[model samples]
Target chain A: MAKQIVKALDGAAAVAEAMRQIDPDVVAAYPITPQTAIVQTFSQFVADGLVGTEFIPVESEHAAMSACVGAAAAGGRVMTATAANGLALMWEVVYIAASMRLPIVMSVVNRALSAPLNIHCDHSDSMGARDSGWIQIFSENPQEAYDNTIQAIRIAEHPDVLLPVMSMQDGFITGHGVERVEVLEDQAVKDFIGEYTPKYSLLDIDNPKTFGAWAFYDYYFEFKRQQTEALSKVPKVVEEVGQEYGKLTGRYYGLFDPFEMDDAEIAIVVLSSAAGTARTVVRKLRKEGVKIGLLKPRLYRPFPGKEIVELLKDVKVVGVMDRSIAFGSIEGCGPLYLDICASFFTYGNGKAPKVVDYIFGLGGRDILPEQIEGMVRELIHIAETGEVKQVVGYLGLR
Target chain B: MGELIEIRWHGRGGQGVVTAGEILAEAAMEEGKYFQAFPDYGPERMGAPIRAYTRISDSPIEIHSQITSPDIVIVVDPTLIGLVNVAEGIKEGGVILLNTPASPQEMRQKLGLAGKGVKVFTIDASEIAMKHLGRNIPNTPMLGALIKATNLVSLESVIRLTEERLGAKLREEAVKANIAALKEAYEKVQEG
Candidate 1:
């Protein structure tokens, strides 16, 4: 396969290219900065007659989701992309898209959800929608952004899992990073993932199914139970699809890739774009005889716990860095990982790794390798003599 | 991993520096290599001066975001030196692809370089764009100099991207003149 070289592309174009390969029935999106160019390119695709897809220039991000939900409900494989404030605007109906279980896939170019109004990349937007009944996946690079968009469609529209999925990439990281990405082949993708066969849809007028039924107290719990069961099965489906994708493309997609953990006493868990920075530190430390590993959570909603516990089995220290603030919480993703580690210790009757929470790169701050290396050094010091640094620390604040 | 060429462009808003960066990206994407093109909007915008960056590599890019460290810096405007600190973060082997009519020696002196090992390729790209394109859009012509200076991606590939990415109506003549301007810019480039 010949590689296509691009000098630079804004974040929007990178996403728009992936959408073109998916070739959905309709794409409805509202314009929002950092995200506007993606739809603008789609609109241009519509105008140039380059793609045989209908593009709806909607009034708002909320409308974009509504239109896609309606389109997917009518048996159309639909997708949309939006960023920070736009995702917040679509908050109300986002729950509806998931609860009614429209297999809609969206790209959340992550940005901070505002009180002071920021447009830069932050996990706040997607993190706020954590419990929205959607299978959320975070991508580390443009290649993942491209591959994940297509897979997101396949996963969301799966027969057993007719749920909405929001595929996320950092606003500028994967979005703006101009790197060579092998846009997957359409036939290979189609053969590997099959066509979108939505099990049940409102579009079938012959049968006529009522979606979003007003469940009374007697039946609501069971309906909710079934949805939870359905959501639980997503990780398996994701693994299956990822395996098939790996066979076609040489790059294997793991829910979490443990780098240099084979001989590690400390493991750092990062999400989205910062994983690359962590890996750099991981590589440098390993070469210098430091046993440091990296855990990047691909599927945040499904939270790959058992795999994490198994990977961290021998390690003594675990550092979790979260890019968003869950105010009044333990800070960053540390609390969540802390809970996971605490559970492991409780259940396994084994010592849990000394866990530390880190809050870094919020509102587009830099995640440098030195900072990562410095933390690992601190962890090593703690490992040598059971002393601890501040458990919940924010990186790069002076 | 093949030829990790990073080119940095420095210019103020409305100077078409960012456009030049995009042109380089367009050209490379035409050649079918994994390429990234973006600009740094650092608490900055029109008239405030900013940077547009590019990284061209054969392998899939794992790193994203700003080109904090660059292999080449394209200075579209010279007065930027007196105002903005243009030479902030350049890698060890990196070069400056500037749009100046000065000889390489004169440029080195103007840039306060006498001892440091730096390759400065100077071209009057703004003049070429005006002469050929009948507009002050130095992006195309300057890109020609960029191709000649760094030899990153071919000038032909750039012309192809311009055709593919440009509107259909503007595709034919714009591609032709841009190629010609690119040739002029590439020819005028003096490496030192």
Candidate 2:
């Protein structure tokens, strides 16, 4: 095992440290709440000459992503960081960058969307961008944020899966919350990420190629089909890279992490930092002889539907906790619940577990252990009675 | 002292409450213990009341939620005593260390801790800071009080970590004066 260099760093600083080690060719960023520290710290690294990255202090998030697209298409390793509104501003270019197949990596510090204008931890930011053709990975803490960042470069640049990757962590919860993180040596990161050899670069004059070409009816449909086909190849590539990374470090990455779920009669399905709290709840419940467990999805995009269905099929009752609301849906559940329900309906073979939708901790509300214990109790009731009073419920809400 | 010790820090934005938490975390890390320190970020301004948190554990900490209940609560700004519920949700037999000129008995009455079973400790940290550093930055002095009250980590380790963390950014005189304030507060903290 590699000697672990433990340091106290927040998620943003940890990601910045990983970026410093990888030392990508270009980093175009604009400051935003919760995510400002990432760029701020990396820019200092640039100023201190710790990394040879071209740091672009862009005007807006739109311009930031645009610069990333330009640099990435030119065959340079590129990355950026942003939160809620900043991500919304980068919407158009976000899709274009992925469709153009630029292997750019980004750190998305998850935050709530605006209307009343709240800047706190929520899955709304990244959840809104789920269909933007980027591979999304959610992290539970600073360590996972750092690990996911380093792994994302390898996954994005994989020849079979040339797609932009978003490594996400809760905004103020993980992004600004400090934790103990074990960082790998700089050389190990360099060897793992390796050099970016673009398959088709705009800068390669010898084999000049056209990108973002206009496609009409006959070819546009085919192009969309090809994009889906490329996306289908992501799961295998992600797993392979995860296994290799696991070999390098003891920390293993997977589509989803299952905790104490082998024979659990009741379980909670969640993402990001909440999973840690759920695990603590699980331990407490387990000690009291409650067969409860937790399932946390690390890879959100490429949804990993089959894996999730297989993991939860045997459970009697499951609660899907989502940090982002899927407004106007018939079920009125959050996005993660919607996706998990859809997955079970498709692949569960009529053995679908009785799943409930829980909208929790939106707008940075605190989700305490007692609240999780309440959810577990509800799940147990559902398992025994085979009845769910409400299909969707809000946790820790007034 | 137990499996984990969670501490909540209350102070104004510019008082270095966040940096104090970070410095303590660095000291705990130096002791080879797992630690976390972060501020509850808001639309921060110079004197706005701010909260920060720190967790020290023999094993790795898994929970990332806000420290709703803490084993120790450190108040770096004396004005925030009644404005914010500094003693809210403190663990039973927890410690509350305050930077104030008032005696612990006076603080207990002012803060309404008559039967809370929580130990109250106070030190004129601002006076100490003013005497040594010529400023009222009570964070370092309050940290010294924290070490005396909770004994979560060694005073020596905290002072050394403070120097390593603030040495380059602060002048040598400022660093030395802060160390003096830390030592004085450590010795002068009083309990009710």
Report the Cα lDDT for candidate 2: 0.91
Across A95-136, the per-residue lDDT of candidate 2 in tens digits comes to 998888889999999999997799998999999999999999
Model 2 sits at a Cα RMSD from the real structure of 1.2
- Local accuracy of candidate 1 as per-residue lDDT tens digits, A1-398: 32333334455566788777677788888988667767888878779886778888889988988888788788888888898999999998899888888888888888877777777787888888888888999988777787788778778878888888999888866676565566565566556556777667777888898877888998988877877888988988888888777777766776766788887888888887888778877877788888788888888776667777888878888888878777766543433555466657765456677877787777777777777777787888888887875877778776
Considering the two chains of model 1, state its CAPRI-style docking category.
acceptable
**Every candidate's lDDT:** 0.76, 0.91
Compute each candidate's TM-score over C-alphas.
0.90, 0.98
Deviation of model 2 at A168, angstroms: 0.1
Tell me the lDDT of candidate 1: 0.76
Chain B in candidate 1 has what TM-score?
0.84
DockQ scores for all the models shown?
0.40, 0.79
Q: How well does candidate 2 score on lDDT at residue A280?
A: 92
Backbone Cα, N, C clashes tallied per candidate: 18, 0
lDDT of 2 by residue, B82-112 (tens): 8999999988888999998999999989888
**Residue A391 CA error for candidate 1 (Å)?**
2.0
